[model samples]
Target chain A: MARVIRTIGWTLIVLGVVVLLYVVYLLWFTGFETQREQRDLADEWSLTVPDDPIDHDREVDREAPEEDDEPVDVGDAYAALWFERDGEPIVSDDVIYVVEGVDLPTLRRGPGHYPESDRPGGEGNFAIAGHRTTYGAPFWSLDVLEPGDTIHVIDRQGREWVYAYVEQRIVQPTELWVVGEDPLGSGAPMITLTTCHPRYSDAQRLIAWGELLDDPIESTAEGGERDEIPES
Target chain B: MADNDAPNGDDPGPRADPDGGGRGGIPRWVKAILLLVVIAVAVVVLFTTVFPWVEERTQDPTMGTMLTPWLAYLRF
Candidate 1:
């Protein structure tokens, strides 16, 4: 009886160790191969076969004009809102814009700060954080954004990427599930905008979800692109 | 006639019972095998279904920014 018990115990221990090692491998290595492949693809696509590259900085400095009614470009039209101690625009070249009417504070982040684990120029969700009621009330109207509203994000290239509103919900603060990668399942990409609820209380979080509705419009392509653009 | 006076005291009763057979307990080896099978199934399910779903949800922003290029890549 003692011999039988000892053999069984030893076998179980070995099996458990093997199972654990396999799980670790899946989480840390093999599971991440897809992302690496995607990154490689991106790098390959970004390679430019220069047609007629010129000094962009020198050209801009030479062409500066005074008393212009319209923006110099579409990129300039999408401005980042910065707060002041006494109500003034905080001007900086690094600031990025949030979706119009997203209740600014919820999406507000410090200039040039991006999360390390996330992709810098991805299409699915580009979430920014800001205060709900205070700090200039950026996201005050966040709860009021209905379906079909357009949220625009302008990248450094002066291209505008538009995302259309889909849904919104209020959930408990501890429900980290909302922030998790698999809110629904794989292949269903979405954006989740979140803020503290009830204006000033941290009781709950309000989330507004949206989906990319159109491809990004490069600054040079806007004039001709409008005709081919679909209603998103 | 003499042997039938009383039954032998050493005779055993039925070996198997509906609720409590003496040998019905699962051996430790069987239990270990079962545990291994359950764990393997769980890991397979998580990797194939659960993990991908979670990755999609949490990586949305990253995915969204890259979606255009990714879609174009797929076309080729």
Candidate 2:
């Protein structure tokens, strides 16, 4: 009887050990490691902006030649503003805004903003949200982006607007100021990218803010020249 | 006493039955119950622990190559 009891105890101990090992393997070597690796790679490519130039304005608005006004190609416009990582396309169907005087669209779970808010390409903050972990993790590397990395927002009219990153902040889920109606003051054009924080949970949101660096630049024109319109 | 002594005099003392009074062994129902318990435990371990861990690893962009299907699922 004693021998049988000993055998049962030994079996339970072995089972426990096996379970523990499996848990450790999954935690350390599986999805967690993958997330870390992707972020690390992204960090290598992110360019940091210098603090000394914070007050300096490098905005530009070059007027395009009136004669070259043939309808701009939307495909070219998309290509001009698109960003790629590891040869995988990161841009989605959603459009980001970079033009002044445009109102930000309403925040929603899916594609396109609320109808009452600004329409895509119309301008304000053409904000978009994506999952940081699931859904192919499109914005998983967004945190790796640093100040000065270019964000391009192209319109269907073949007008491409360029933005330079200014700052990034991790905000609580309840903080709506990151997407405030008066982001950067009234009529200040900006582009905001948001994603789930910590790259694992949706408990918080991470935001990256940028200001328009130049006026709408048409892709059809030679050498990517900016189009000038009267300032609002 | 005379009838009991003569027929089994050559036989040894009363022997114990190897089959325990002809009673059957553990029932099939008991075996089935044990199997179900094992399966339940395995499922609990998988969903509560294993699944989350796998998800975390796949979320990592660096290890994304190891989970091609997981990455593909991210597209809308």
Candidate 3:
């Protein structure tokens, strides 16, 4: 009986070690791997998103990327987001990339724009999602946004849509009512950003909402301060 | 006139080696049963716990598409 108990104890210890190792892989090593993968995505998006222009302003009557317009791939980066807090593209700051389609592959690149929703600066809800803790964790600092903070969404043509942060909420993943709405009733374009809450768990979801300002500012390739072409 | 057939004749049908199952000497049936149990546990743990935890932590962005349904099923 003593030998049996001792053997069982040893087996438990071994199993415990294996679980610990797997947890480490999930938390740390996966981030490094994802960052490497995101680098490739960023490089490819730099070349593609620019040449393809998407118009969100009704005044312009420009072509927008919808299912009917073109079949945007799931992982295609449609826009780039910059925080006004960052201010003037300094070192250690990167424009968070927003790709088309909210899925594992698309979000692995950065933030993912939910398909079947309005584009940035459009007439309706432009909902997006990202990872808070892993897969490059683009929205890791999302909690830091305060009401009235400015979020810049620049498009492939270097046109910038400025949105003012309104409010944030935490809800279950099933509480997806915040996703789609008629901005016409609200009389402005809206944005919704989502991620898992509590930093390390997915039991809940964190959501940030914003409203796009009218008369969005446009940055020309020649006028923009940055050397690289903008792809919002 | 007889084929030295162990199946027909009296050959204590494949007697266990005096030294037990194999090099480990624990008995082959015991090892096989143990392996099967481990695999079943691994499958349940992988879908119900490990994968969900990984998806939560890393967001499993690209593959997360497929895992969404599995996560939903295992939520309960």
DockQ of 2: 0.06
Off by over 4 Å in 2: A1-117, A155-159, A213-232, B1-30, B37-76
User: On a 0 to 100 scale, what is the lDDT of residue A189 in model 1?
Assistant: 45
lDDT of each: 0.39, 0.43, 0.62
Candidate with maximal lDDT = 3
Ranking by TM-score: 3, 2, 1
TM-score of 3: 0.65
Which 10-residue window of candidate 3 chain A scores lowest in summed lDDT? A223-232
How well does each candidate superpose onto the true structure, as a TM-score? 0.35, 0.41, 0.65
Candidate 3 C-alpha lDDT tens digits along A8-84: 67567766776787667766776776677667766766686654333334243234544323456787767777665
Off-target runs (Cα >4 Å) in candidate 1 are A1-124, A182-186, A215-232, B1-76
* Candidate closest to the true structure, highest TM-score: 3
Tens-digit per-residue lDDT, B4-39, candidate 1: 123566434453333332256665466567767766
The CAPRI classification for model 2 reads as incorrect
lDDT of 3: 0.62
Give lDDT tens digits, candidate 2, residues A1-232: 5534754675577567767776566434444443443343223213221222111122332243434333322211111133323322234322222212211111111112212223233346655454465533446567555433556644333345566555666755545555655466747566666666666654456676666655522322122332321111
The CAPRI quality class of candidate 1 comes to incorrect
- Give the number of colliding residue pairs in candidate 1: 28
Please rank every candidate by DockQ, starting with the best.
3, 2, 1
